[model samples]
Target chain A: MIDPLSIFLLLLSASTPILFAALGELIVERAGVLNLGVEGMMITGALAGFAVAYVSGSPFLGFAAAATGGAAVSLLFAVLTQFLLANQVASGLALTLFGLGLAALFGKPFEGVKAPPMIPGPFRINWIVWLGLVMVPLIWWFLNRSRGGLILRGVGENHDAAHALGYNVRLVRIGAIAFGGAMAGIGGAFISIATVLQWTEGMTAGAGWIALAIVVFSNWTATGVLVGAWLFGGVTVLQLRLQAAGVKVPVQLLSMAPYLATIIVLVLISARQKFSRRAGGAAPGSLGQNFHALR
Target chain B: MIQLVPRSEVSTLWQFLTPVLAVLATMVAGGLLFWVMGYDPVAAIKTIFWDPLFGMASSYSRPQLLVKAAPLILIASGLAIGFRAGIWNIGAEGQYIIGAICGAAVALAAYPSEGMWIFPAMVVAGAAGGWAWGMIPATLRNWFGASEILVSLMLVYVAQRVAAWMAFGPMKNPEGFGFPGSRNLQQYPSASNPELIAGTGTHWGVVAAAVAVLATWFLMSRHIRGFHIRTAGLAPRAARFAGVKPETLVAFCLGLSGALAGMAGLFEVAGPAGQITDKIGVGYGFTAIIVAFLGRLHPVGILLAGLLLALTYIGGELAQLMLNLPAATVQVFQGMMLFFLLGFDLLTRFKIQRRVVA
Candidate 1:
């Protein structure tokens, strides 16, 4: 018989990476800029964090390094797409490709190295898991009640109007994007520093994209992100369990559970949102468009 | 009051010239990158751009160029069609894998038998495999409004693992002492995708790619469906009013793109690749996306773009061999292409204006 508590622990561990990335992306979209470079940033973080943790033998510091690395790269994206008014999608794709190449280059020497031990959690759970749980409510309260939060929502709602009201639209978006990058970095670090406890090529395994989808599935809400992460975590853990049980299904087929589940849930939520629009709110206006300030 | 000057419209000449211009610009950018990497930039560029076609080793490398370009062109042509309509199918790599597996399975079913029907059956199976893989996302999008991009891209990893499992397990050559691959298709002449004329870099894939270019050109320029795709991309609402069903277009684009990608994989397995192995997928799917965009999502343009990209692959390899450049230099070039393409494409969509707030 499968242990429910073990499953819960596995779910918590799996959800940490998604939680960190989705939360960051949520804050970004809330600021009216759609940056699709989360995948790039996360991978970059994975390499940087892994390198740090591997060399220094401290996973915590590795995570800190990852967040800083991810944020720094994200700032480059911010400068090009935000300040230079470059197309968001293209810039994001460039970032992903650039990040992948750069990671491959920097991580050539560090390939196949064992990662340092993870910072232990309460009762067998890691601290990142606890941090993920804490971040959900933290993000919720900040989005709803904080002073800077209102300014971000204002920009997302209408950049022109927000600027008309003398709010620093560019500054707010850049900060949000940078924060999103840091969060994604932390998410990437979780993979190397916590879950795998090892570094490998293309190690993020599309987790960043999954996190992006989760943000949409959650309808840009915090608690929804937590729920979405758990759901994905469950699917992933269930697949691994099925494999261990020597099920008749092909391991390849079983491995598809997470991706298939993501597609299904994403479609389900999209359908719900589409149908619920009569009562449901719309996606923020001015989303994904570059804003130009004529000075 | 602040004065704003309207930017001039880019002419038709610039429209066609931009891709060529982008290539030159990429060379300059790539050169600078090479210079930073400590290699003589000029030598690296020549070894990459010129050596594969006209260098002393051109005889060997030149044939390889067509061999590589054939599948990329064939697959990218299909993707370019959908991309033009704003339908994104990023799962070509998955489709390619499925196609190779299914096609090779067909050939294996006729194992050691001199069956003339084997090659034809494999071709159909390959196309079917790709079409089926593509329909997963297309059907979901049609039924439940899913994001095809995510579904399609996710399927790639799934397909990859499936390929790995097959190579190591059920599909493993029992006679070959625990090897993680299947019987070589090249050994079965009846099942093989033979070159039309040997030593000319000709294959079924090259023929298919050329045919695809012509077909797509006709479809996009003359067909009503083409009009719908273009209209839908330009204005989805207007296209809807014009009686184009968004769901139907999504399925058609995804399905067709998938079929072509599958065909490319099949041809590779039956011809150049010669087996169903773990290395069946070699980043062609992702690279094809770049080809679709670089070609500006036009069929004829994709043909040129495919060859150009194929050149880089061969050239990058040449550079690596001759100049000790990194293998990822090609990817860096591709990144620069998209970076420049996106930046330049802005001219087609929006006119720039300068103003000062008083």
Candidate 2:
């Protein structure tokens, strides 16, 4: 029988990566930029973090490297979308492809290698798990109560109007993209360094996509994202428990639970927004639109 | 500082020139990557681009190009239409898998039976299965306002699991010591999609891909529906005023593309792959997206782009054998090509001018 507290602990650990990624995406979307390369950046971070930690014998340094690596990859996207005025959707897809290939090329050496063991925090959870928990409230405050957030929301709602008010729309978006990349990096590192304790190709295995789903499920709210992440995490942990207990269900069918749950949650949220006669959906006005400051 | 000025009219010359420009830029960037990785850049490049066409092994590799490009062209032909109509159906991979499973189910059910109707029946089942899978996101988006991108992508994971389930459980071969794959269709004459002309790599899939190209060209250029699709993409309000229904366009585009992608899967399984397995999808669906963009969403362009991408696959393999390059090198080249393609697209839509500081 699965113990209640142990299962709860597993849920928290399982949820941390998506929590960090969704939080980062939240800020980026709030700033009116849709960066769909979270998976790419996360994988880059996974390899970099794992390699750095292996060489230096410190998981903290590995996490730092991951953040840096993720941001570096995001910069390619920023240049393409912001500076070159490329289509955001295509550019984001290109970034994912590029990052996955780049990581695989570099990660060849790291294959079959164990990541440096992570140190547990006060509650015997990994330190990064605690960090993800703390970041939820912190991000909530930043998005809901901060001046910078107001500016970001303004830019997202109406870039032309924000530009008229003398805000630097491109600058704010660049900053948000970078922050999103860094957060995604940490999340990816959490997978390699804390959870899996090993480096493997495609190890993130669509967690980044799941994170993207969680963002929508949260209705672009930081607190809502927390709930979405936990919901997903709980499903994952329970699925693993069922597998370990030798449940009669096919493993492949059992593996589909989290993805199916994401689709269901997304439909439920979207249905409510559609049928409830809510004033307006919480999506930022200028989401996915390219902005060029034309006078 | 440089400033971009929007062109009053898109430059026809730039439209034709940018793809070539992007290719050159990718070569340079890829050369740099190869150099940094401690390989002889020139040799690596030559092995990938030149050897596949003119080298001693060209006879063997040249025919292989058609085999590789058939599915990409078929899938991209469908996708390009939808993309032009402003509907994103990124779940073609899932649709493809479902189609293959459905098509293979027909054959599996008629195992050891002889009938000319088997292959045709499988094709219909494949397209229907794909169309059904594609409709999920279209229906959800129409009724519930869900983002089709996320929903379609989510289904890919679901489809993968379903494929795995079939491989291990219901669809496993009854013979051959309980192996987790179905009976090979290549061994079954009625169910097989063999190369029509030996040494030419011509098969039913290749023929289907050619038909798709011509059919989409006619549809997009000579049909009223195509006009509505273009109008909707350019201006939704104007399209509405012109009597275009967004829901119909969404459903039509998604359904059509999903059907094409499904046919590609059916062709692949019945031809090259020969059986249903957990790992049937080797990312043809995703790669087709790149092909659609690289071809500039044009039918003729897609043909050339599909061939070019097929060349890269062949070349990448040659390089892997001769130069000891990583298997992922081809993936990197494709990604870089797309990056350069998008980056260079700025030139096609705008005129860059040097800013004079006042």
Q: Pick the candidate with the highest lDDT.
A: 2
Query: Among these predicted structures, which one has the highest DockQ?
Result: 2
Worst 10 residues of 1 chain B by lDDT: B1-10
What are the lDDT scores of the predictions, listed in order?
0.84, 0.91
- In the predicted model 1, the residue pairs found to clash are A121-A125, A295-B357
lDDT of 1: 0.84
Task: Give each prediction's DockQ, rounded to 2 decimals.
Answer: 0.51, 0.81
Q: Which stretches of candidate 2 lie over 4 Å from their true place?
A: A278-280
Residue range B24-128, candidate 1, lDDT tens digits: 888999898888878899999899889999999999888888788888888888888787777878789999999888898898888888876888899899999
